[model samples]
Target: QCQGGYDEGAGGLLVSFYHLVKLAALSDRCTAGVMPPGEAPEEVRIKVFLERDGDLTIPTLYGLFRGADWQERETFDMYGIQFAGHPHPKRLLMPEDWKGFPMRKDYVQPDFYEMQDAY
Candidate 1:
């Protein structure tokens, strides 16, 4: 998961998970996603953005389960993407008791939170 900057001056934060399958594939090195995670259901596509000197490349795979089913739910909740074959495709961040996507860039941060100490 990654968080883009709120202001134009700050660079965005990029977060990635290193799965055991990936370690085995890369023989223990870091990697990045070349394509967005939503592209393929049967494969996990990752791009190796950085590696030891003389070793850098993009790679993709067709068989890898990186996490529990709920993990995909969290990704969906935060990023608003559907994992085609994931089980229990339900809201994981917003309460089942609430409404609408809260993490979207356009979501208005509630003024009450912003103004609480001003009064």
Candidate 2:
């Protein structure tokens, strides 16, 4: 997968975890791939950009999952990359009723939160 800002236009490819692991192990530079979660196979795999700062900075990805559940939900929670055939694609953090993906660059924080103030 290409980095966040780098748009190589993947044309939509279904990347497997095994492939990602192999790429990460073989290459020193960062790579990107799509991870799908749950029974729903309709989800699209967006390209992700890995950051050297430790966190995988996905420019187009965003969300809030509980830190305590990181290990169990890391793939789906933070990255929003769904594991196509995996079971249980529910909220890893926050309440079940929570609306919208908070982490996306296009996410609009309602009411008191203003986009301009974020900078």
List all candidate RMSDs to the true structure. Answer: 14.8, 15.8
Task: Give me the displacement of residue 116 in model 2, in angstroms.
Answer: 30
Q: 76, model 2: CA deviation in Å?
A: 4.3
Clashes (N, CA, C under 3 Å) per candidate: 1, 9
On lDDT, the leading prediction is: 1
Shift of residue 106 alpha carbon in model 1, Å: 0.7
Poorest 10 consecutive residues of model 1 by lDDT?
1-10
| lDDT by residue (tens digit), candidate 2, 1-119 | 21112212222222213111234433434234333332222223344444322443222222222321333244444334443333455667644555554544434566753334333
C-alpha positional error of residue 117 in candidate 2 after TM-score superposition, expressed in Å? 32
Whole-model Cα lDDT of every candidate shown, in order = 0.38, 0.35
Residue pairs that clash (backbone atoms under 3 angstroms), model 2:
1-32, 35-81, 35-82, 36-82, 36-83, 36-84, 37-82, 37-83, 62-103
Clashes in candidate 1: how many? 1
User: Distance (Å) between predicted and true CA of 21, model 2?
Assistant: 6.2
